[model samples]
Target: MFIDVVPNRGSPPAVLLRESYRDENGRTQKRTLANLSKLPGDVIEMLKALLNGGALIGTAPKDLAIERSLPHGHVAAVLGTIRKISLDRLILSTAKDAASRRFCDLVVAMMVDRLITPRSKLGFVRAVDEETAATSLGNLLRLGKVKDHEPYEALDWLLERQERIENGLARRHLKDGILVLYDVSSSYFEGHCCPLAQFGHSRDHRSDRLQIVYGLLCTRDGLPIAIEVFEGNAADPTTLKSQVDKLKARFGIKRVVLIGDRGMITSARIRDDLKTSSLDWITCLRAPQIQALAQGDGPLQLSLFDERDLAEISSPDFPGERLIMCRNRDLAMERARKREALLKATERELARVQANVRRKGSTLRSAAEIGLAVGEVVNAKKVAKHFALDIRDGHFSWSRKIEQIAAEAKLDGIYVIRTSVPKGELSAQNAVQAYKDLSRVERAFRSLKTVDLEIRPIRHWNANRVRAHVFLCMLAYHVEWHLRQRLAPLLFHDTELDRGRAARISPVASTEPSASARSKKAIKRNANGDPVHSFAGLIDHLGTMTRNIMRMPQAKKHPFTLLSKSTPLQDQAFKLLDLDPMRVQ
Candidate 1:
């Protein structure tokens, strides 16, 4: 017997049960067994299955329950990216021993944890333990019962292989004659035990705390190539030589264009380290140098920017180099506004000091005392050169250095980009753009210090561990950088920035986001009408997908694991990442 459906003209299809047999003459015959049209569709199907000698079983929520569930999708996305980029293999040593494998996993786990939720080593270990299991990262890596000290030990192991790992990254990302961007930033320390931490220009504005300074070298696209740690007391320019040596001696890059800020690629550095070397460089002129260029009879004329925002000029001081001068009205307005504000603030403070000096029986009576008080106020804003002050016993007066301020204002919004690369190899526009790309390094510093990956408040005491800690963070950022590029469609990041650059009138003007980016920002959604997210927010949303352990109470058997069905958004994320959330990376 079999169940079949027959069409009845325009009416609903008729469901029927029938039987077939053969007579003595071998002729075919059939009979209607039942009119199953009145039965529910599922019931009819079940009847057909039973007639075909198939056993039927029932399952209900009460029979099977979810015994355990853990967050898994985010782990899959990030860890999957790590494998996609072969970061694990890049950082791992050549040793194939089981311990080496586990250590590699440990390093990867630490990096994943840092991206997911930055924590202390002990805290990370606790989160990944089988009992706690805050994220599926630990279980996915098969890091069973991670010890508290293992992460530190992994750092030690990683530091030993830092050169090899960096060499691998450089080989992957760097090429001869490419633009290499380098910038330095400092992060404050929590304790005084580490030898690398000391007082320096606190980018974090924590002068009271000891800090460590580090420089990041990146490709023209802003992907990190390598990083080096220095004593917090190290000046920005002082760190350039070691990087030069590393690029030539270690990474074996014969020719490249190094991009640095004016502070890093100073005149002294150029004359000493880079002038005689094969490496070319791109940097901007300092305020003093720009002032000299704009002086009377100099090459950089104010009228040069009247018709256009950028011009290529030359001077005897910078021979055998291309100088690209640029002006932006917006920058000029902002600088004028800030200078006025600082001047007003300084005047107010100085007026208070003058009142104290003139008051009867005032403590600020000596000329030395009055001069000291006046110096503090003028130097507070570093506009002392723009102010004129007079100090005498029991008397004080101040006035704005109008001529000087006017001289400085003439150069506002004006900057000169200097490069050793020739005009044929790199145009004036591209040279200015290369100098502007230094902002990418600045953006990386923002992400490293305060935004996504917090690399500050150093607690490790050993210098090597400190170095390893920083390198690990850089690796984590490396993974994140690639992930962001892949997931940019779903993110608030402007994926059409290159188009914007192409549309820009001049490289000197401020960059504007693409129209699509503007729409995304206004609507909080992408072109597909899905919600857009910051990188962190997207990671958090992906964590909603979980792995569930299912059990049958009556069977008294072992439980089986099943992944929760992904939401549309979660599915879209995995698709963008080209990852399978069900598979462990």
Candidate 2:
């Protein structure tokens, strides 16, 4: 709102009022009051001096609120706790500039939501319109503030934060030893120029792109502790032992039971890594590969397996194997039915082939050959074939095909679990249970891919930003994981992921960033009596309240008190972090 005291055509300025006050020397002083609140305080103060208007400003608290109106309420939920870890702030604020703080606040906003990156962060921070944002972003880029490659640096920041949390956790909960679940997977990037991208075994049908190896070490409760990036062409088996070694070296964890999928690590490497290293491991092996071990009656007994998920064992120096009983009667029947169906399919194909041959005036020549080819499609046009039937194509009967399928299916489904733990240290049944516990890693991966930090296409090109980007994503995951560990049971027992993360975030916002936007327009009359208006938009910033904030800290001039002026966003952040919601209310 503007005052009507000033008329058109800036011929002369209208005086608002007059006042007298005692000077610092206790002398009486006369002053002319002017309406300078419409402009920024700094600008108004400067204008008063240029025109010799003796401090035409409201120094009194009651009169200073010239711009007050509605309440711009904000809520800060979780940023309070995150601040205690000061090292993290230093890393993200690497540049120590306008851009760095802006990026950091935006990232903190994500951490508030629990994580984002070039591709991921780009999805958020969308402005009022695409063009406006794009222009602002382009300017930011020119200023070296916001770039496409920022997320990768964020990834590094993520790892660093993980270390902090790990150290913090050990300092707090020593009894609940950390459960480390390990796993390996590959992600392919479709770019020839990508140095780390290469073609290797892909879990997804993405052989066309260069595939990179990734190994994750997650907690039993599904929180990621470490994630390593490898060259695209690297093999999983070769890296497993080294990662295990790295885990020990970095965290100095000796009491960890490394649970892993059978395919993640080789048996030979397991022995090489864990035999001397103070660690216990549980892994499942392919039964058919170890068929001799399965069929033997001396070492391990299958029938002795007390329960379905339970197993019994008795082996040697390293440990023993568990023969889990197949108690799933329904699964057993399904397996049998599946075998029967295969047999039928084979037999039908063989019969169709024989019929086609007979119609074409071809003879089986003999019963032995015909029997061998039965249930197999010898001729391509006779019937669709699923597998090889001992006999050649175009001459089998439906029965032989069915027999072959049934034979194959009969030997297909079974499970064998292996352990390197000693009999005294860990029982066979315990080993089996331990392997089940290993599934914690998979759950952690699920949260990484879905629940919290869904960092996929990793759009950052500059390595540091990319690292920083993924780092925050990881940090968010860590925060939520801890939140759930500490608060899930307390607040929600049956909540699925969608509801959990939504409710777990610390509801918070900082008010300083929006200060410029909250200002009224500054107007000035031109020589022709035309009014010119100017206003600045949002400028992001961040600050934290200190424990010794009770004492007023003096700036270069006099003692300053920020007590009355509240940074509303900071208030919300404190509330979200489960800290005090207000600053000394």
Candidate 3:
């Protein structure tokens, strides 16, 4: 028997219970069992349940309860991807001991939290207990009901296997002859107890606070391979030698080209360390070096830019090395605009000082004080070279050094990259491209510091914990890189093809309606007619696919979990990642 709704014109639909039977001649005949609308609500529901193959003895309305509702969809998706990569297995294989496996799970859990909702290590236990109920991580890793100290202890265990874990990652994602981008960044500390924490150049602009320096090594595409932490006082150039040794000795990478910013590795160090070790490198020149290249009769003079934006030349100062000089018109324009703004600001500040000197009733300041005031104005603008300041008779006057300004302006938007890779092996254009890829390491640092993983405010005082914390954040970044690559169609990723030379592609302007109009009209497609969403929006979309727990009354039956139906877009995302959305089951 089935309950069928009968349509009636200009009236509410009629609900009918219909049953079918075969007559003696094998012809079908139907009869009305009952009118469901006329029956009691409970009776009608029971009949509906029986017809739909539901349990007849379901809990009564008053006895039903919701055990808990969790935000399980996003966590499940991340964990599914994590398992597909066999990250947990790779980590566990380092040590077969039970404690090691548990610690591995703890690390994985921390990484997931880092990606989803970052919090302090002490707060992670509560986050997992509340937010990750649908993931099997707790059961698989045996991290149920974590103690506050377990995460720290697990970090200690994980730190012991850092080399092994890094080796595994290198084997998986790295290969010989790949361009590896490296850079260093410092994270400030909340308290200075760690031996590695000391006063250094704080990249986060927290110079007043102590910091710890860490270097990240990643592929040209920004997939992090290894991370190394050092004392806060370690110099950027000083860290390169150890990393080169690790690449050669530990990872066995023989033919890789290391790309770094000029601040990280000087020309001298490249000559001394990389040349002797037979390792190739690509790095840009400092401003003074670029100026020297622009000196009289040099190959990198300003006249070279008139013919082309890039040129390959050999310099006598750097024998047997190729220098790729590039000048960007847009960069030049930007620099010119910035210098004008700074000059104006400095003029206004100097005018204020000059007014004080000319005022009749002003305090009688000494010549030294007036000189100091003039110095402060020029220094603050950082354009002292372009200005000539005069202090005489407790008065000040200044004028623009037109020749100096013109000379400095001649070098705007110009940069030179020095590389040892032979022209036949790597062309000058590719060398420029490779040196520019140092921005990928910069991107990684941005993600680590401000974006997904906030690897700052180093609360861990112990050296081991600091290292482990950085390692955990890097691991999380590895996962994030894969996700972003798969989700590139929805993100503003660098998708231009390399055609053996550099090509600048302007972003295609969206012709879609304004955001306000789109919101009112419920528009979700981009100008390309593809679905448009920010990374966070996509995550929130997938998060709609949740796990629901339904339970009977207290002291009755145990609760059962059911997954919410996935939308087409959510299913597509899972398919792209090759993940099973229902893997939690």
Candidate 4:
């Protein structure tokens, strides 16, 4: 039986209780059981619900209560993505055994925790504990009563499986005749205990702090494949060999082209590590090498870029290799501006030193003293080569190296791409594009170090622990990269990358957003009139969706979990991910 409302002309609708019955001819007909029109609307709805077989637990509607609510939408999005990608299985192949399965759960939990709210091991455990849970992550993963040391143990187990896991990823993403992008980065350490923590070129600008360097090997489009940690003082070039060997021997990939910056794939490393191996390389020429190419009667003349931003040239020094030269007017102008600014600043500092030397009762009485004062000012700006200094006992003089500065200015905004791939295999234009693709790897590093993952302030005292920590962060970024790709439309990230490239006058031109992206930026709304957000903003917005624990006066002892209603935008995000927030776990 059900309640049916019938419209009446010029009067209130008639609400009637009705039942379905079969007549003698076997046709279905509805019969009015009672007139519910005189009853209140609430009572009528209650009767309808009861007729539909929905149980009413309490005597009154107000008897039901919400006991607890936890942030759940963000958990659902991230954890759902992890499972959707089969990242849990990737970490540990089969969870049939209870103990291995639980360990795998802990590993997966640690990874998602980094994405959701990056916390230390102790803090993560406290955040996911049943009583002190910050979100629905604990309940969703069913990770009950986690101890502080369990996370560290999970890291140890992950480190042991790093090889197998990375090999699996490499096989999935890498192939023969592909461009493999590689780069190295460093993060400062909090203590001096770990062997890998040594003071080297501090990319974090924390020269006072010990650090560890790590290299990331990725596909040309920036999907992380493998990562290797090195001692803090390790040189960038020194880290390339292991990655090369890993691709050739460990990952079992052959005939791949390795792309790196000039500092990484140096001439020496190439001759020693890569040249003998049948591997190809795509790297840029260092400043000195570019300067050498532009010297008197050299092939890399400025006129080559008069009508174009990119051109191919040959060099006798680098035999049997193709060199593609590119110039950007904007980059040239910016470099000139910075150079002049630094020169003026250094001149001001040098003037102070000269005055100190010639001032009455000058303390600089010897050449050593005068040279010491002058030396500090010259190299402070790193444009010391642009200045010529004359220092003697109780005297100091300085002048600009005009010829040197002019020569450098001529090469401003100019760079040369060096590649070993044949012209048939990869054209000059494509090679330049491949080298430019290094920025994608750089973007991954930014997400890992500061932007999203915060893979810094290393506190692990064990070498393997430190390695596992960085590896975990890399895996987290791998997940984030996929998330960003799927969520690009809702984010400030440019969705029409191909369109933007098409709009550019030259491949070397600065990037510009497409028309649609510009509109989104200006109006702060997408085509659907929904607000566009940054990745972080979108995550926070999803966090607003919660899971509530509900109970009633009649069934207070057996509370049920209920998902909060999701907004349209949240629904769209789930749609994009092809996930159901209610059934995430």
Candidate 5:
């Protein structure tokens, strides 16, 4: 039996308690049991209580009741996906002892929290205590109450097994003949105590702050395979050999084409270290090398870009290697614009310095001072090569180096890539595509530093702890990569068509009224023509599903917990991730 509300034309809606019965004709029929509106309020309350298995009760004082809610749905969704990926089992297999296994679970919990809500170690502990939904993680792991220091302890343990863990991941996701992308990025440190934190090239642009360098290795599809940490003072070129050794010796990968930026591994290292090991590599040439190829009467000339945007050539500089040159018209325009802006700004500053030197009745009469002022303006722009300036007899003269500017303009938007991999193994276009895939590593670094996992502002002063901190961030990214792939329908992911070509679902808008307008227009939609959400927005939508613990005033001894039902959108998201909303509890 159920209570039903019926509408009327001009009177109060009728409320009837009805029961369904099967007639002898095998047809279902509903019979009116009672007019619920005609019953007294107390009798209606009793009926509701009876219908709810006696769990519902008459109202009591609302002021004395306490209610608490925690973020459950998003965390559960992430945890469920983690379990489906067998991450827990993989971590458990790495453990040699019971304590290590428990620590592994703690690490897994930390990763899940990192995905849902990134927090510091102390903040994580507080979240675990305050959010009852987080305690559900403990239930999933079948562990007792977690101590405050266990997360840090787990980090320490995880550091010891870093090699084994990364090796396991590489074996699972990586294979030979794959184009492996490599890139290095630095995360700044808050303190100077960490041994790994040294003053070097700061990729974060925090030159005043010390930092440690870390290299991320990933497959062609941008799935991160392993991460290596080096001293803060390490140079980019110097870090490549160690990574190549790691890929060959530690990860046991063979016949893989390593791809990196021009600054990462130099031509010298490629000719020596890589050649000695019989390994293949693909990387771009530095500006000087490109200039050398274009300036001289070599096979690669400025006329090459005039006919076509891409061409393959041979160079004496890199014998027996294919040089694939690419020219992007958009890049040319952008570079020209930036160069002109810098030149105009530099001219303005130079004019100010010239006026200061030539001012009448000025005390700045020394030639040394005038020379210093001229040197400052010239060196500040770093465009001294494109300008001719001189100071003489309290007067200054400056002119743009027209010939030099024209020479640079010819090479604009042109870059050369050197690869040892045969054209049959990988064509020039595919080689260019492979090098372009380096953006994936850049994206991974962006996600690590600023987006998903905030792997910066080193909080741990101990070197091992610092390593573990970064390692934890890498592990979180591992999960993030999978999440992005599985949730691609709702995200702006590259889709591969039937013709074996990749296409971006959301193409760059050619024009927009404003930046905000472009952002608003960037939203993607699913096949249903409904607007899809970004990864963050999708997580927030899932977070709306909550777990509630209710305590009735009449039933003081019984407090029951129930997971809130998912809305249609939330259910759809769960379906995309292959997670059952009912199993979230």
Candidate 6:
């Protein structure tokens, strides 16, 4: 006889109990459990994650009590509107694959936290266990749907919301008009068998590894607006045309101009892309072959040119070839300072060597590298020398070093620029300034490298998910970059200082790198011997908004009615997000 299993709309198929089973010919009876029901949420969560794209076999899961490893443990809360909700609940809404979703969430959080952590403290393995990680990440994997690191889901998601985002941008954003810098770069990862991971030229010279294509779009303000994935090993010049064409078709862009490096300015490609839309482009020119007419400043000569000036020159192949030259007093001072520093450095070396020879009681010597004793010791003096270096043969060393320093200082106060811009529209000086803005792209790359994203050693085994991961990073980049621009006025830029330096230096001092510029490394080796700044320190300080967990006091207020104290950053982030901190719901 058969009995009805549980009858419920959402209940899983019931496990069947066989009362008795008899063979047709012989007299035999058997009983067994049949038709097992849906796998438990926790177990299913695991299975789904593995299928989606979590690397569990190679990794060890977190040490969980073997008894109840089902529900994963602990998700750190973020700022603004989404903090109070449990990690699982917040993630529960749309995970198609339970396992992948959990895994994705953890990884995303880890990525963010890493960005805000000091690089010196960064390591490959920060998570406790592989299995535990698998669980948290499963949720993201599930929603992603297409297997480990698929971009299809992300692409579909973006396409679905295209109308809304475009409308919002058209109406409210792009106030400064859209200056789109379109380019393609590739990210490399170790997994070669991955269909997505194909051979490509590595920007970091890691062609030894497999790579995939990535497209980036940025605002003139250095904000990343969108990221797309192309086939691995795609050409940069060709990647340019497609992205430019696609953006025009999909978005409501007003006054869009394409800015690209010299590599992308192909005449044939330009004609093809222009035929598709009426977009303007600005590109750097390789020096054009000079004409005797241009040589003598014949008619049609560039109008705005000076010792420090910008002048536009007309070119048949391109338009808006405005040449500009500009002088920044600060840059000029830096030039002088650097030359003086070099002289001082050479002079110091000469003195040190002279002292060393005297202490050793050795004869006069030549230049350290040149091996030429290019000076004469016309005078001799002995100064008390306690250190390892000695004072001797003063004159012979002095004359040659002085000559060398003078030669070095003589070549100062000069630089130049050339452009194809029309003579009347722009000057050589202004054109040079515009070209200098190309540094913005470098700043953008630094963010992609250290601050908001990590695009190297791609580990995704699947084709689509790799793309999706990159796309999401671009999204985060957009958010954080815009936040930086907004926060700049509030926090001033310190040319030479970072958070650590800020603690020692005045907060308002104009010589340090502040939180806004923390995304990029501002200091290079300068002869001044100033302290180096750290991005890691700035991120740790700024991102760490302090909070105190308190027990509600015994009072008329209900336990559920308790409130927490306000944090300055929390309040600021809340206001920026347009969230109500008091009413979390």
Better of 1 and 2 by TM-score: 1
- Candidate 2, residue 355: Cα displacement in angstroms equals 7.0
149-243 in candidate 1: lDDT tens per residue?
88888899889888999999999999888899999999999898999999989989998999999999999888998999999999999999999
Q: How many clashing residue pairs are found in candidate 5?
A: 0
Models ranked on lDDT: 1, 4, 3, 5, 2, 6
- How do the residues 1-585 of candidate 6 rate in per-residue lDDT, one tens digit apiece? 232245557866554434556688767675655543555657545554664675443234432112212111111112221232122232233546855454544444433433443121123122223333322223322333223233234334444443444334333444323556666677677776777677777776776887887767666656565666776777777777666655576565644666676666555556777435666566654322222224455422433323322233454433444422223445556766865555455556657655655565455543342234322211111111111222233333343345534433332222233343444554343344444445566676667755556655566676655655565455445444544543332332333433444363221112334443453334432223222224333233333332222223332243222223444543443454454533432
Whole-model lDDT per candidate: 0.90, 0.47, 0.79, 0.89, 0.78, 0.45
Q: Which 10 consecutive residues of model 6 have the lowest summed lDDT?
A: 378-387
Report the C-alpha displacement of residue 170, candidate 2, in angstroms.
7.1
Greater TM-score among 5 and 6 belongs to 5
Error of 2 at 259 (Å): 0.9
Model 4 lDDT tens row, 1-585: 889999999999999889999999999999998988999889888888899898876667778888889999888888999898887888887547787777788888878889888888999999888889999989999999998888888898889899999998988899899999999999999987899999999999999999999999999879998999999999999998898889899988779999999999999999999998878999999998998888899999999888999998888999999999999899999999999999999999988888888899988778998887777877788987998888888888889999989989999999999999999999887888788989999999998988888999888999999999999999999888888888877887778877777566677777778878998999988878878998878988899999999988767699898888899989889889889988988
Backbone clash pairs for candidate 1 read none
Candidate 3 off by > 4 Å: 1-64, 130-142, 494-531, 552-558
Task: Give lDDT: candidate 3, residue 225.
Answer: 89
- Give the lDDT of residue 197 in candidate 2: 60
- Summed over model 2, clashes come to 67
* lDDT accuracy of residue 560 in candidate 1: 78
What digit string (tens of lDDT, one per residue) describes model 5 on residues 115-141?
A: 777888887766565443353455445
Residue 352, model 1: Cα distance from true site in angstroms: 2.6
User: Candidate 3 has which clashing residue pairs, if any?
Assistant: none
Query: lDDT, candidate 6, residue 523?
Result: 41
Worst 10 residues of 4 by lDDT: 498-507
C-alpha RMSD (angstroms) for model 3: 6.4
